[model samples]
Target: MGKAWLPFASYNLWSQFAPPVGQERWYCDMKRGYAKVRKREPEVTAILAEDTQPQRVGLLAQRGVYEFHADAQRLANDDGLAQVSQILRLEQESHGVKERLNQILSKYCENPILLGKRIFSLSRGDEGVPEPIRIRCGNYAFHLFAAIDCIFLEPDGTLHILDFKTGRSDFDERQAFVYLLAASYLYPQRRAIASFYNLELCKWSEPITATASQLNAVRIELMRLAQRHEWEKKQYRKNPVDFERIFPPNPGFQCKHCQFNRICQFSTREIS
Candidate 1:
């Protein structure tokens, strides 16, 4: 699928269907269309990360943590890894990134259980893999924007997908399953596992591993979602401004967190 056709009825979107808010699907379509046409990123102003650490913590968490994992994996492989300069360079680039990274890395490095693991991406290494793992199955496509925070490649070839959470909020296991689904496609030959790590709470979740059959079921679901999204997208292209009927909105509490809530008629009760 083309970049123009993203936000394609993602798992999260499908899960949001319900009530009066879901009734205004058209409004949702218009909001998505406006974003695509204008080439704008989703607005994140409404979201406030509870951590005292700056917003940069999250961005650096992805980059810095990946760097750490790559270096550690390379070292395990006896590939003559060079992480000191890498860490130094990262620290020099920004003020808080290094400090935040230390807090995260210390937990892993200090723990004896986490020391021996070789972390790697399911598709490939950090150097070449795309920022968000994009998967396309026919006309229906969904971008896996949520990167797996850390993946441990076991000796037996099991790929463990780990997501690092900095906050205290309850963990959502579905997100990890999404990564596992992506891994199933990216590295079909290997067995895959998924887990969540809460750095703030210092807790590790029970491991969840999916079977080939379960993953195949998810793949089929995604295909159906993609086809339906493609059909609706055509409707959106025909009349971008008036695509309300096809992509109706179900305005309600979800609007409060919606990036498009500011411009949605059902939410604001005013003309856009």
Candidate 2:
């Protein structure tokens, strides 16, 4: 017989389970319930299909960077920004998206961050579902999905994992830690660091690194999160009606921005 599949964990799941520092007031467990547990439901599936404005901007910004670095000449050419805009078909996007992307692309053309580094990998950001990193913590085994945006080697030989941001979202150190942990497994021999860069704000976070013990602690925490998430999923499957009980809601003003607000009965706002 085949072995049983392990539960999965990612920074996305971690954020859903627990909000970033200072954002606790807006955290809602029911949102995770809808987005992860009952996502296969038609109503939920429909809502999840559409990307929010912020999400669109972030994806396009990352894609713009990818396209710029794809061809080195684009970074040097005077009309590089315009060329990439045409390639992205920026005209098709909404005004907000187009304007934000134009700024991001223009800035990247002016200063391509990865220009001189020996890049190990750079994702276009639309690649669905990165290959999972199998992790075994104590008796628990689970998959760790980390979609790293970019990785390059420093002159000193450290592997640097760089995550890109678009909007005003704060840099979640947990995400950098997760990438550091993933790097530990992927490049067991190489020392690594991780950081975030906000394209819109032209901001860069200080590099983040973790020791062996810290990475192990992160692994254990993810294992626990995976087990808890799987348990919640099983409970919901056993009794669909008990979803709210299993994943209680904290409806408030934030629901207006929640992707699942349209279908969530507990949502505070009446999303049109």
Q: Model 1, residue 150: displacement in angstroms?
A: 2.6
Q: Which ten residues in a row have the lowest lDDT in candidate 1?
A: 43-52
lDDT of 1 at 17: 31
Kindly list the per-residue Cα lDDT of model 1 for residues 1-272, writing each as its tens digit. Answer: 64553644344544333212334433354444444332243442222222334434555545544554544563344322235325536546455666655665555444423456775743212343344555766565566544455678878878888776664555665566667887876787878888877664568899988776876666666556656656766776788675567666656555655556665666744333
Give model 2's TM-score versus the native structure.
0.96
Error of 1 at 239 (Å): 1.9
Report the Cα lDDT for candidate 2: 0.90
RMSD of each: 7.7, 1.9
Clashes of each: 17, 0
What is candidate 2's lDDT per residue for 45-117, written digit by digit as tens?
8888898899999888888989988998988888888888998999999998888888888887777888888
CA deviation > 4 Å runs, candidate 2:
1-4, 270-272
